[model samples]
Target: MSLSPQFLDELRSRITLSGVIGRSVKLMKAGREFKACCPFHNEKSPSFYVNDDKGFYHCFGCSAHGDAIRFLTEAKGLPFMDAVKELAQAAGIEVPASDPRSAQRQEIQATLYDVTAGAARWFEEQLSGIEGAEARTYVKKRGLDDKLVRAFGIGFAPDSRGKLKMALATHGHDKLIETGLLIQVDDKEPYDRFRGRLIIPIRDQRGRVIAFGGRIIGDGEPKYLNSPETPLFDKGRTLFNIDRAAPASRKSGRAIVVEGYMDVIALAKAGIDEAVAPLGTALTEQQMEKLWRLVDAPILCFDGDKAGQKAAVRAGERALPVLTVGKTLRFAMLPPGKDPDDIVGEGGSAAIEPFLAAPSPLVRVLYNSRLSEIDRSNPEDRAGLRHRLDDLAKSCTDKILQEEYRRSFTSLFFEDFGWKGRDRTVVGDAISRTRRDIKTYQSIARSALYGCFRFPQTLLRSLEDICKIDFDDDVLKIWREKIVDSVSARPFLRDDGVIAILEADMISPPQKFDITRDLRFSLNVSPEVGTARLTRIIRFLVENEALSKALDELNHRVINDTGMGNYVALEKMRADVRAKIKVIRDQEYESGATDAEADKEELGGAAGQSAASATA
Candidate 1:
């Protein structure tokens, strides 16, 4: 059965080679392809590889190679006709009958390939001839050398419409029109579609010319023109320079996407060859899939302009529904009012390397783009942003990936606003109690600093805790620093001596506070009290501050997350922190009371001794 070449091409394009082979062989994703143990020749390690982009399976172990049909015939032991019928049915395409007309159509399709190749050669010749002098000058002015011009198959279409028609007349006007080289109207003579323009050929995976893109040499309404949709060319499914970029991407471990073919060429001239561009359209799902077949995350290097950002957003949206675990995109933005061409042209590939080196992830780009449209300060606007982000995350077909995206978006949103929120009622009364605890901790910190100044000896033991204090007031911080320096310099300095040193350094001691006055005074003057009271105070302050921070984070999580399991977990954590703070406060109060009583007894003993001495 002789199937038409066009039918066979469609069959291969529609069927994914990995999907077919995966039915029998276990395939694992290897960058730009899938790998499995060679089924024909068993081995421990995987030497068999399948590339859906190029539509072929190869085995390094046994050197077995074929396409979808061949796989079915050899692996499944199906006849060639039976394999073709099976694939055609799966692809939802009708198998062409092996008749005289099918053979004739096959012959015509073969000739069409020849016609496009012939036209590409003719355009190249025109570029190097007298008629292309203006186009050649334009190319030179753009910094393209002769070597690059030939490497990219850069050519020219003359101003005269009939010239291309006459040059390729032997191929017949019908074939030329079918390949989109000549424009034909109803009952009208066909003429050249591209005239007075510089041509760049668009090729398939096999490096066969399928279409042409042209840029006008001078002022024109449409700055760029592309060949109309032909049997061999579908712009949405095609990318410029894909044939060259596929291998380059395999070596580089990534592919670079630009806004135009010219940008791709510019990077190529700068010795960066792993670049491709969408053909006159925003990137489509088909185009993104093609890129994923080359690398996990292709870098989309768009111009740093309004339109370019919009293009990136569109590409991101298109990719959301089909996203998998390992497949994604990264975005690179050029400097404002510049492009890859401008960067490479000015400073060679070095200038563009930085932008490509640290491209933003797709999620960040999407989140920021949506975030920029709303007023972050407004509650309603912020809620709207969350909703939009949630919707975007839910669009992913992969459930695990969807959940991860949700977490990422949520984390990003909270990071911008910080864990602080206006809700004081989070997790019942936890947030309200935390607010009060913050004030209590601040007062304890103040009292600790005041106590340190009075008894410089206490500072010697708790010097580490003293340094850990987060003083909000500059004056208090300065005072604390001076006291620490004085005490650290002389560990046995008395209260009056330390005070004198502080005064000498022009640092004022903290004003006495009534909040914990008895405990503070007893801590300094009474050696019977020891350093335990001051140590407990500092520890209480530190623990309270840490608790407040942890509770704040949990509060934010509990409020933002709707999952019952997570909410319950976060609530329990908040409860535990509140309980811990209560225990610390209780211990401090009990210890303070006992020390106050001890000071009173010491005073009473001194009074009795003084009275007895006076009486004698």
Candidate 2:
């Protein structure tokens, strides 16, 4: 908050606003200024013009205009600090640190991170030692060699109840539980994190070992076990081998995303280095965002099995909207009953390399999947197939991705069904294609909220990061901005408040319901520390007074813009805030009321009221 207008003006001068906006949005010169269609509002014409010299962007039609910081904060709805950091990184500029508390948390997480790396090395040492005969034999039988084992950090966790625990304890790692390395049953005895298992250390793209995945050595109830949610590891956010795979992904401009830790390891060992896998959980929007940092286009590569194909479809659905224009995605499936690892292990990575080399449209997969199940031999099946493809095409939100899918898919359908010529006879094809988007929107709905929650101090920063917004609709952007502003001020929410507020911002009731379900599922993951973690997330986003001011300004635009209208969204937001304020008001009445909580509440409520009044 101490940062003055002069300091901001100077900072803006040091960075090119066009270059910053160009990170996520493609910009071209339109005379003196750079012009691109307002990503914040859907338009056939370019109105979102960035005046490079002035270091500002103004969308005359939509009235969404701002500086480099504002672009980032609005585009992604990130916290103000987070947006600043994002832009600062893009500008190749250094951002000064604000609070020492963030530094402390980072340091603690670093220690836990080191512990994980140390444990992996220890496990690796055991496997390479004389006692690792069984572990060595198991991989060798699967076509992995000594080089592959070492490359993947393939190691054996001894079978004894407290073997690795004793090893780490001797090395002065008594706090293994906090590091998520040694599990304690009753605070009485520490046990090995992975017992008689094949250990696979999970890391971020930075190569920090934040968690671990252990594959059982023999027949076990749960075939694989991963580290529980820890401060250093959030299963939904981490990916396996991303750090090792990023260089290759950047060079290749694509990455092969797979199912398990071993899939990535096997692919890497087989000379396919651009492979990453989700860690101990389903692919999340956060993971997608993470992958976007490394590669422009990502290919979903699941095993050619029933479950894998299903997962691929679900993941692709979520990825489509987030995939920036010009950037693309494809899917690959190994032969049935075979995974990337299995195929590569049996016939070398060379055999599987061809599939990973190209991106295949999801429509082909969907079409083939549908055709194969409909008794293709029957004459009636041909008619049904034609209609299905048409309906599928119309449902797509992105024309470019859809058109590409259509071309490739039409070829396969003609060949498979033996139908020649462009005969577009699709049946039961509804004119308004039902929303077939497969992404459960687990994090996307909370995207606006989580933007604030993740970095409480800089709630407005996320919105400033994305130079453009592309929901393909103006009204939607209005709702999005309002939601971002209202949610950013929130320091933390009661469960019911969160549910109600999230639902208020969504396009439909089902979408709101989906968010509530998904958020609860993710939050319930770390039951022991859920409350503290949620509180911390809130504080991180709404970090400073300046951010709150910017958010209030942004929120007012959303509400006052007559094009957006007075929907239930604004009303619901008001009701939620008033109800929440009442609860705090009651608590203050009970306890010795402190000035701090009361004042922050007043500021937050006033911001919300201003947004509401603007609509009125």
Candidate 3:
């Protein structure tokens, strides 16, 4: 027997077209449709196309075309009946038996749809009547004009329980109860399920009303009410405004999931029609799957309140297990104490546009949510954050994805909390050696440089003579120049004032060398010690150089000279030079240690003074 047209259409709608075609063909998303090399007869420029909205695949090269069933029958070489059975199984549909009652059941289901549709229209008519005056005012207060009200089909339920039952009495009370328009009890009469609330119809992909959502007008218990699960309405699997959102999503290349029907309506009113919402529940895996069919990763824009943030976290947790490659969610939270409606009211659509354009990815949202839950500086709390991250990554069934997430989270954790990597030991050792070398270099330079900056008055007279010496170290030369500049700018310098000059010049320290830390050694010297020590160090350095040069000249003359008289004279001058060199070397060695000891004893209080200075 042939399958019914209604069953075939339902099957087609259930199975995503691109997903079916992608199993054999490596389909790539090209705008709203997917493209692949034609499987029938491929010349390799991706002439095969699949459109989920159209629920079919077509090959432009060979003119081959079909739905999911036809593709299996033709491309996979399966028989027509086998293809139909396979697709039916995948779609969660049972093939109708040849028995006549199956057809009767289908007809009865058709009547239930008609009943819900009639109730929706009746509710819409009530919104325009005298009893709907309150709802109309609520709508106007929400800034919804006539066009948006008609577009979203906003309606009202009369406060009386028997009003809906009486208005649709022709559809029968039992039918209305079956369609979830009324509630039934064991012994009492059935009454309306929704009352004194603004009614919103929930539709399926084909735009047929399958359920209803109601919001209480004033302060009432259970501010929002949704229809109970029925044969046609599975709340977990259905999203509000999906029928309208799909085409808009395709055009804009985005799908936005919000928290409620009112939020979706608000977004649509702001000209952002690509918005949908789960039916009075946290987002489910089935709902996310439905969203992914429209866009690879949908934007989940939740409110900024604590409840909304908690809802976002719940959605992220639910999505972890089923998060496959190219399928995820982006999270966008409104500003504090604001929802889409509130934002639009204050600043119009442009206010929420930036948030929608750049929502955080799923991994970022999960990472940030866990991070926000704890104080990272507390070791126990930080450990908890790490454990939560690992747990989220572990929930993923995809091994590659799980490992990638683990690596990313570990890297981010270390970078944020100042943890080192495996090679830190080697790096530390090298850095220590470089620091020691820098310390030695700074020490040698500071011997002569510190006195000049600390007590410029003592050295100001010797400045011309000191600048005449060609110093071996570049830092000494630079320090000497800084001292001359400081003295010229200010006639007499205080110790603290001189140190400030040194610090200002050392702001951008040379790479691979840090001398500023040891520069504090100058505080160990008093003005008298600095002046006396500087004179000794500078004189020893200059005189030692002069004696060494004179000795070298004498030696060169002795080696090249031919007359004995000249050689004798040169030898006598060399001996005199050697005697002078010995005295200078002795003084240099003795003076450096003596000055160091004297400065240390005189400034044993230097550390305390430096601490006070630092506090100041």
Choose the strongest candidate by lDDT: 1
lDDT of 2 at 333: 68
Runs of candidate 1 with Cα error greater than 4 angstroms are 1-105, 418-616
TM-score, candidate number 1? 0.57
> What would the per-residue lDDT of candidate 2 be over residues 1-616, giving only the tens digit for each residue?
2455765666788788888778667798999999997767567888889998887899888798899888755564344665665555555665554578866775676577667888888889888777778887887777677777776777778877777777766445455888677777775766776788888877764456777788887788578889898888888877788766755564455678999877887777777887888865668888888776655667888988888988887776666555556555578767789898788877787788788776576656676667776876777877777777666665557887667656655666764553222221320121012111112121333343443333333333344432133333455455456546555666443334544665676643234334443342233223223323333333322332233344345445433332223223333433444443334233221133343354356456656877999999
- Which runs in model 2 stand beyond 4 Å of their true positions? 1-96, 170-174, 185-190, 370-616
Which of 2 and 3 is ahead in TM-score?
3
Order the numbered candidates by TM-score, best leading. Answer: 1, 3, 2
> Backbone clash tally for model 3?
0
lDDT per residue (tens digit) for residues 1-616 in model 1? 6777888888999989999889767899999999997866647999999999899999898899999998876664444775787787678877776788975876676688899999999999999999999999999999999999988899999998899999999999999999999999999989999999999999876567999999999999689999999878999999899877875675567799999989999999999988999998999999988888778999999988899889998999889999888999999977788888999999999999999999999999999999999998899999999999999999999999899999989877875664423332454566676576566666567767777766676786678888888877788798888888888888888878877887888785644557564242344345424455566567667777777777777767766564466566766766676676665565444456565664456446555766999998
lDDT of 3: 0.75
Scored by TM-score, the top model is 1
Error of 3 at 2 (Å): 10
Which residue pairs does candidate 1 place in steric collision?
none
